[model samples]
Target: MANHLDLEEQEQLDQFKHFWKQYGNAITWVLIAVLGSFAAWNGYQWWSKRQAEQASAMYEEVERLIGTGDLVASTRAFDDMKQRFPSVFYTQQSGLNLAKAAYLSGKPDVAKTALTWVAGSKADTGLAALAKVRHAGLLIESKEFDEAGKLLSTDFPSEFGGLVADKRGDLALSQGKSDDAAQRFNEALKLLPQQDQYRRLVEVKLAALGSTEAK
Candidate 1:
């Protein structure tokens, strides 16, 4: 009976050895892949967080320059932030702020360049749409009527429909198309929320165009 028990234990040990020989390499590779992916994921998360923190610091510097009314310094800081962290949210925001500052500083060319960059970038869609609208306004100021029209014609967020219509009205009015301007302004009025101050401005435009029903 003792010999039989020894043989039974040996048989069990041999079966375990056979199983390891058959599947040990595949199991080892599977574990290695899972562990590698987890390590990679952790590394990516850490890297992304570090990048965001650094970009945030740069954005604060840009904001400080803007607050000091130093357009040149603000632009330089923004450029640095974009170069280093182009995919960051703060970088896109810096572009918008820089464009505004450039425009107000009588640097329409700089403003347009920044705005165009934001508009064409893979930033947030709403921010991109806003940049396009602002760029269109600058184009209108420069009498680039066709280009402004094209920018306004691009698809925007639903919330921007009214603003886009108003821009179209401005373009039409600039081109001496009063009827079209009035129609577009009326469309803007319909699309705008009741409490929107911009709606009042559109109403004024419609009134100027001999449309008494803009209220």
Candidate 2:
């Protein structure tokens, strides 16, 4: 009976050894891959959080400078934000703020430069379209008529299509295309939703151009 029990134990031990020999490497590799992936994901989240926190703090600084009406300092801070955190939301906001200050301070060229960058950047498409519209307006004011027309011609997001049409009207008028301007203004009026407050402004533009809605 003792001999039979010893043989049973040896058989069990041999089975375990066979399993290890067949699957041990595969199991070990699977565990290593899972652990490595988990660590990589955790590291990425930590880095993203750190970047957002740092960007938020810098945006606050830019906002404070803007509140003080320090256009020069605000410009510097905005430039720094653009350089250090170019892909972040705060950088785009800072660019817009700085453009406003520059334009209000009678620096139209500077305002146009900043706005043009935002418009052409790989930032959110909606905001980029808004920048393009504003930049076109500034160009019109500067009498860069042809360039303004080109800016207005670029495709924008759907929500801004009406706004783009309205700006195109302005550009057409500047180019002495009053008939074309009237047509664009009429199109803008129709594109705007009934409840949109901005629709009234477009109506006024149409009226100024001596155009009425289609009967």
* Best candidate, lDDT: 1
Instruction: Tell me the whole-model lDDT of each prediction, alpha carbons only.
Output: 0.89, 0.85
Candidate 1 runs further than 4 Å off: 1-17, 212-215
What is residue 6's positional error in candidate 1, in angstroms? 5.5
Clashing pairs in 2: none
Name the candidate that leads on TM-score.
Answer: 1
Put down candidate 1 lDDT per residue, 1-215, tens digits, no spaces: 99999999999999989998999899999999999999999999999999999999998999999999998888888888878988887888889999998888899999999898888777578888989989998999899998998888888989999999999989989899999999999999989999888888898898888886455
Q: How many backbone overlaps does candidate 2 show? A: 0
Report the C-alpha lDDT of model 2 over 17-97, residue by residue, as the tens digit: 999899999999999999999999999899878888998999999899989988889888888888887777767777787
- State, as a TM-score between 0 and 1, how close model 1 is to the true structure: 0.87
Task: Go through the candidates in order and give the C-alpha RMSD of each one to the true structure.
Answer: 2.4, 3.0
TM-score of 2: 0.84
